[model samples]
Target: MQLNPEKDTELSQKVNRETARLPWSELMRHFASGNVVWIADELDLVDVAVRIAHDDKASVGQWMAAGQIAKVSDAQARDWLETDTSLWACVVSPFILVQQQKIRH
Candidate 1:
């Protein structure tokens, strides 16, 4: 399938506009349904969402292999719940990709 750059850019913008900072508690149900993916702070949440939306398996697989992304684990969930963490999240269909909010200082 040929990828249209213009379409991809538009999709990225849409995903960026849809992204938000959501409380972990609010996302518990999605996590429970095993539909939450934790994205590392080192990566751009919107970029990840765009890649997932495009089904760019090679990029996603490389990120996963490098420990830059993964299914939210029980331990991480517990930590987030305990801390009342708010994460930057973007939905890519069946999955909600989240990243820890970057610290300014």
Candidate 2:
């Protein structure tokens, strides 16, 4: 899911706004990290966020604001992904399921 450059910039801003300490690049990298991948499986959130960032950064901001993704500090997000596999999967799975449903529909 390739996002337009403009949207990517905006989404990055939005994600940053919600997770103050987690920069967009860092977040993406974190999502892609081996630990996160092993614990949480695929990174659908990062993929979608990347796509959304390319198109509508504001919407990404809205998602972060809506508390769909646990808006924790960078340390906490990292810790959660590291220590809480079930919780991390719970948060990430819904987005992937929703996206799958959208594609199916």
Model 2 sits at a Cα RMSD from the real structure of 12.1
Query: Which parts of model 1 are misplaced by more than 4 Å?
Result: 102-105
Tens-digit per-residue lDDT, 1-105, candidate 1: 467999988997898888899999999999999999999887888878878888989999999999999999999999999999999888999999989963221
Residue lDDT tens for model 2, 37-84: 221123344444444434456665555566543333457456645753
Q: Name the candidate that leads on TM-score.
A: 1
TM-score of each: 0.92, 0.27
Residue pairs in candidate 2 whose N, alpha carbon or C atoms collide under 3 angstroms: 7-53, 7-54, 7-55, 8-53, 8-54, 10-57, 11-57
Candidate 1 Cα RMSD (Å) = 2.7
